[model samples]
Target: MTDYVSTTPGLFPLPDWAKEDLSDLKGHQKGDLIGGDEDGEIAAAYEEARGEVIDRQREAGIDRIAEGQLRWDDMLAHPLAVHDAVETRGIVRYYDNNNFYREPVVSGDLDFSGDVASELEAASDRVEEGLQAVLPGPYSLADLATDEHYGDEAEFLAAIADFLAGEAEAFPDHETLFLLEPSLVESPPEDGEDERASEAIDEVASATDSEVVVQPYWGALEEKVYAHLLDADVDAVGFDFVSDREDNVYNLQEYGAPGSISLGLADGQNTLVEEPETIRERVEWIDDQLPVSAFETVYLTTNTETFYLPYAKFEAKLEALGEAAELAEVKAA
Candidate 1:
């Protein structure tokens, strides 16, 4: 029988201390943490250091451990690395204005430069276990880039979709591509806005054979978008539970039915440890509605990104999430 898998929410803000800890690892003793023209020794060391973090997460029983995006300066930088066509400037501090866990920003065009592909392959090779490469969703990236690059957001979004699809196509061997769309649940778009964005995302979804999971966070998902997502080629949809728990549960029932779901039950952005019982209860409710078999795969996740948290806080959150999963297995038994 296929066992039920418990995975934590993706994206944890990584503090300098965590970066330091990663640096101490053998393969990453000399690598750069935030990119730039750092020495090759620093780059290799830094990549290996991130692999250490992934190992820790797997040891904690996480089904899938993101590289913690430790290599990135910010979420936007991740896309910037792959798509070099756009000139990325730091404007409109993402965290300062938006209350996000970290600072991210607007960019120019979709540049699929293939900068990250090699690093991803290298990192994947370093890790003793399987790892996922997280990238911001094209729609969310387009929204962030709206005012900065193009006046026509729809056209820009379409370009981003094409860019992301190319990035996905570049990596054929990764187990899954965790495409994060924390902004997808933001303000409901105007009349046809939702449809336009959905079409763009569909292209990305269709471009790859690897599993594509659409993960939206920080806000409640609009019913229309949720409805449209159900019809996409996505393998699974992810939701944030620490913040918009109730609405997400409803969305899961109404729209996530019959689809694989990665439940975001941990707070990746905050330091507070989530209560295990709370997580178990939420899983039980979903389990009751969708047969455990239909539930297929219920992965645990943090609310947003965790790269901003201090090491103590990040470790606490990870530990707490692991506890919650342990409690879930006990209850399921």
Candidate 2:
């Protein structure tokens, strides 16, 4: 029997109060508000927002909850943007979405800055259930930024993998860690690069006792890229069924599912709320496509970040996901 759990990809929509608090810091760069007098104010807002998000997730019966990533104004690139070693360059479009993030320029040796770890620690104290921490995968982070210090791409990736590994080592209390890798689907690694990327990912995953899930969204990964990831040391790999359901399902049929799989059932970018039964049916369909015992546990989640949705719609999506998980569990029993 496969246990079904519900979680989001993090970067949830900010609540009204947090938004208002950020309004004054408009012209300031991403993460600039985290110092001096503004620091305490902003931190308070984040705490309130995090509590609200966790409370909502609990109310919806979600098994794993994130810190809402309220400080990630620059999205996944935030961890790097906030680091003193990395310089923020011009704005870049985030994947294919209308959203944009400050491009992180590697100016010096990558190092653990303790920003994310501190936030995770504060959030950990607020939540009762297992808290999940989110980060950009090494390959994806390397792809997103330009390197000025590291002469070679592989060197830069390895440095990033090490930095991320150090961050993971700092947070031994987190139950799950999600490494988002949209670049894998958008720009598949070149021939020999796949092995290097996988090794870097393994390095980060090995540093954590928490269950690490590498979730690549936007679209289905190429056959070769998908195959390489299965060999990585991560606990589970998430596929975006919302963007390209047929192709993703076909990939599973061809390559076989991983030991643990996260099936993205909710469309995070859209405003329309999917019915709970509809999501359950989709999960059931995917389960039918996989061989029995192929996956030990299946996670139900949004295809991408819920920050793209309005607060109300994001809440609705969470409710739908929770309901679908319950439905799947009852049917499996």
- TM per candidate comes to 0.82, 0.95
Best-matching candidate per lDDT: 2
Tell me each candidate's RMSD, in Å, in order: 4.4, 2.2
Off by over 4 Å in 1: 1-3, 8-10, 15-37, 81-83, 95-111, 146-151, 256-258, 275-277, 286-293
Candidate 2 residues lying further than 4 Å off, grouped into runs, are 25-38, 291-293
lDDT of 2 by residue, 236-316 (tens): 999999888888887888887557888888998999999989988998777677742358878899999998887889999
Q: Superposing every Cα of model 2 onto the true structure, what RMSD results?
A: 2.2
Where does candidate 1 have its weakest 10-residue lDDT segment?
A: 95-104
- The residue-level lDDT of candidate 2 at 172 comes to 38
Best by TM-score: 2
**Taking the tens digit of each residue's C-alpha lDDT, what string does model 1 give over 1-333?**
223455544445444654565466433522232334446665665666566677667767766666665555545545653343444444355533343222233356665656556656766775555557666777777666534565577777777788878877786366667777766776556667777777777788787676667788876788888887666677788877667867876776676543567777776756676676777777776577654446555566676677656667776667666777777666666
Q: After superposition, how far is residue 8 of candidate 1 from its true place, in Å?
A: 4.2
